[model samples]
Target: MPNKNTHYKVKNLHGTSKDRYSKKKCECDNWLAHWRNNTKSQRTTCAVLECARKATVGAHVICVDGRMSNEWYIVPFCKYHNHYEKKDEYFLDSRVHLIPVYKLDGCKRG
Candidate 1:
């Protein structure tokens, strides 16, 4: 959980610039800095309705057995859009999500 102070700092930054670390993406663009550079491991874009560009990894996509829940879930969001979107979704550090759930451990993603 983020404290009020942290939230204030982020808000201040985001209010001024589109930097997620600086906290101003809604004003600029949703993708964060250093994203194209992090592609060596696991990195990708937002899984929302019609978003473009690459989002940063926030969680490892996971799903527990037989439960319509995000128990083992993850949230795929850039530092910017993560704070903005998710109509009906969950994600993880890898920053990816697919509806109706997929076998994350069952499949491999970059």
Candidate 2:
């Protein structure tokens, strides 16, 4: 049987998150709207890149499949960071690279 107390883990299956930004495309118009209200500006703390989005932690699609990552929330990446990723370069997208990559313990998981 499933852990009844852990039902919180299944909440984000259909893009049902507190913030819609997590499901938005990389270059969407509303991309930075949520963070504008946040005090962090665009600072990120994830291991993916040293950049920052409207969010410190971002909802990332998995490379293994067209699915959102069940374990990691890519964070702190600046707009330049996503460009590096689309180019398939080794500079960005480094897991907990030169900077500290702390995992978000409370982020909704798929």
Candidate 3:
């Protein structure tokens, strides 16, 4: 049986609740949209080396420090490499190089 108390515990993990994460995603849409529209090098090259696929999505490289970092390294990645369950393994093995997308001074991922 699922613990009824599990919900409270999860709310505190990584300084974020599941509800907060969802809310943040909605808030960040404008920032993402602006970035996609304004960036000159809308990266089409896949971060994974030797892959000829055109990249279409921004994939965040999870930071090593283990705290859910607001600072993220966004790499241009194809759909397959971005969202697959085995992405971490592929990243570790391939050591995908990421390009840093500079956040504009006034722009915030709120």
- Where does the lowest 10-residue lDDT sum fall in candidate 1? 5-14
Name the runs in model 1 displaced over 4 angstroms: 1-43, 59-67, 70-72, 84-110
Ten residues in a row with the worst lDDT in model 3? 4-13
lDDT of each: 0.33, 0.30, 0.41
For model 2, how does the per-residue alpha-carbon lDDT over 22-102 read when each residue is reduced to its tens digit?
443333223232222222333443223333433333333222222224543332334443342353322233232121113
Better of 1 and 2 by TM-score: 1
Decide which is better by TM-score, 1 or 3: 3
Model 1, 1-110: lDDT tens digits are 42322221111011323333333212312222222222323445654324564656433233432234443233344555545333333322223332222232322233
Could you give the C-alpha RMSD of every candidate to the true structure, in order shown? 14.3, 13.0, 12.2
Clashes of each: 18, 8, 0
Q: Each candidate's TM vs. the true structure? A: 0.29, 0.26, 0.43
Model 3 scores a TM of 0.43
Residue-level lDDT for 86 in candidate 3:
35
Candidate 2: worst 10 consecutive residues by lDDT? Answer: 5-14
- Count of clashing pairs, candidate 1: 18
lDDT (0-100) at residue 39 of candidate 2? 25
